[model samples]
Target: MERKQIRALGRRVKKIFIEHDEVKRIWSRFDGMRTYIKLDQFEDEDEEENDDDDKRNLFLTGLSGVGKSQIGKRYAKSVPRYTEIIDDEEIDIIPVIYVELPYPFTQAEFYKEILKALGTENFKKEPTVNELRNRVFHLLTKQRVEMIIFDEMNFIMRTKNFDNQSAMEMLKKLSNQLQLCIVCMGTPQIEKLHTMEDEYVRRFGRDRIERFEKCDEKFCELLERIEKAIESPNPIGLHDQSTGLPQLLHYYCQGRIGYLHLILKESFRLLNVYEENVQVEYSEIRLTVDIIKQAKFNLFRKNDHLITPDNVDKKEYMV
Candidate 1:
């Protein structure tokens, strides 16, 4: 296939989203947060924030590329920011702020991430952390931002000896000071925060998007869904027990959905329906195990141990 055609097909493959159990759980959590925020009726006559039942925030942890970031982005997109006329000025009503915590993160960077998500960060000249923090709070309140998703929160935990404790405290502070829902996504290391005796630790719900533990019936069910989405010319019977493909794929992907997605997308690019390879009854081209076997090498550039000959041979037993 030509490079142009291959890329188009690859993009289509990349766009597929199977609402598996994990994904469904994420969506439910996100929607629950959204609904709670809408129904939040806690109030205080005096100058105080009431969080008696404001545990709508979420801390989603998982392995890298395990779909946390994707779900975060999708949820943020669902409640898109928009401009509205209030009084006499155009106001930016950003319901959700989605920003990735920059690596080598600092307290200043933390504030800037939120500012950047709000589309109000001054890039030409850097501002003091104090200034940025004030601006973040002000803008979040002014724009009616309800939820703030801090993706790649692994950096926030490390802080690299740079006011690490204070930085984390900032997350808690944001929730209390602004009564905002704080959603964070990152590696499982971020879950360490739960062990601390923070004032608001219990107010944050925790969930993890884990990889498949086995190539059992559940994994085969996912394969069946992916096959349907791939819209391949002919059904590959990936879920068929006779194929022994589920086990092989579970091994290849280390049960990681990310690697499985990468392999399937690359396979789409490799398939040649009209130009080369086998054509079924002069009608349709079919995906084969051979193509997937070749696609495994496309990742890691031959660096991953999972793709090494020894590992592959051992994992073959699962097939």
Candidate 2:
């Protein structure tokens, strides 16, 4: 394989998205919330979707690498913005907006994130919190944004100086004023965010994506799905119990999808090296346990625990 082929394969592998059961379910939940803000459901696009409970806002929490941010991003991309003419003014109808909060996520920063997602100014120079908040509302309304996905919402709790109470108020206002179904996605610490305010607790319908406790049947199924999704001339057989690849992967990734993805991507790239070094056809090459082991070593050499010899599981543990 030449250098060009190797780089192409790298880019191709990164774009592959496997919509496993959990991911599909998350999309369904988000689509349902979207209906509440659609013109078909409400008399007007900005009409109130939240009743007394305000549970229409969705809160997605999960372990790191369970793909919470990916889910939000992919779902947002599924809906494309278009042009709408109102009173002879052409407004960009961005149906969904995905915003990732900056580290030390604060109230002013939160407001600016929305503007950034809308593709206007990514930052406002020293605008007051109230000023930024109002700008967010005005732009969201003008653009007719039906949904806002706030990724890394958990950072609110980790930062000491951030006024979460004020941020909560901003979220509440964003939901009610714009009739947007606000989706907050982050790690488990974000669960504490709802607990801080009783009203917020009632206002949010929460869902947690429980990661694999350990390598089990569910993890095996995930491997099978990933195998089918990979753009290879032949199957990688990641889930084949006889090959012992699945358990070995479990040992390294600990059931985290993000880590699993990284490992597989690196392993695929290794195929290029093996072919070039051996002066063999790419079609004759395969993803062997040794190849994956080397990829893991190259990837996690600094991390240490992920790249040892004794951890290799060349046998099945299915009970």
Candidate 3:
């Protein structure tokens, strides 16, 4: 086929299959359940434990590009839903405080960011860090901020020395003092923070108590749904009647929900040129699969090594 014809096909396929909004909605709802709701509920219950007078804290650890930050944002968005269940006296609306911990390794710096997030800027009284910390606590306590989400908490560890450790201790102390469930979201390296010392491990509790990874079945199902949402019926080429649709999609995605979308999106871009339905067989998809797998491998190879302080500055580690 001519280059112009191929481009035309790519454009047409994109138009036929692309429901960007619907795809996002589907992914969001599923992500909310599989990732956010589970964690948010933990925090919600922790808040309730304090006679509904205090917020809750939770810590979420996962692999990079494994949907931690995405789910964190969704959890924050869903904070309003908890308001309906909350009594007016207990909390007017569940205030979700989401702070990306890309900086601020010390208690002072951390508190400064907390204050900034709370919209308390420039205390003319020249308050010390302790004072600002107390102010944030009081504000959250009074405001009924039901949830606090710390995304990219791995950044805290990059500050070097024991700063990250000390900061985490302060966080744990605040969680106990305020009876708030604080959700810490970050890459798998975050487990290192807890595993470093016997005391540290004890303070953070057991691994099963905090970190949760998605099951393979759930991941594949998520990818299949995304494929259905973004795929159009093919018309011209050989449509292998012998094979299964879901099976084909699952194979293409290789169990990574994120890569599934990326491949489908790129494939559509390549097929937009012609509006005619072209049958996409397993053979046609082999090239796409190879491309996606190579990309994935290259990405993992670059960062799969131990997350050193230096490597943490790369794109994957940043918020």
Candidate 1 colliding pairs: none
Residue-level lDDT of model 2, residues 1-319, one tens digit each, is 4555544555667766778778888889888888756644536658654466454597789877778878889999999889989999888889898999878877777777788899877453688988888888888889988889999887877788878787778788888767789998988787778788778888888998755555667888888877666656566788876788887888777666787888888887677632445553545557888888888888887464433224434343322
Candidate 1 weakest ten by summed lDDT: 274-283
Q: What is the C-alpha lDDT of each candidate?
A: 0.74, 0.76, 0.50
Superposed on all Cα atoms, model 3 deviates from the true structure by an RMSD in Å of 10.8
TM-score: the better of candidates 1 and 2: 2
Better of 1 and 3 by TM-score: 1
The superposed Cα distance between candidate 2 and the true structure at residue 117, in angstroms, equals 0.6
Query: Which runs in model 3 stand beyond 4 Å of their true positions?
Result: 1-59, 81-92, 116-128, 196-220, 228-254, 259-319
Instruction: Give the range where candidate 2 is weakest over 10 consecutive residues by summed lDDT.
Output: 310-319
lDDT of 1 by residue, 108-211 (tens): 87788788888876667778888888888898989998888888877766666765556668788997778678887888887776546555466788788887
Highest-scoring model, TM-score: 2
lDDT of 3 by residue, 216-314 (tens): 344444543444543334322112223333344334333333444454556454433233465434224332434444543444444443233322223
Name the TM-score of candidate 2: 0.83
Evaluation by lDDT, superior candidate among 1 and 2: 2
lDDT against true structure, model 1? 0.74
Q: Model 3 clash tally?
A: 30
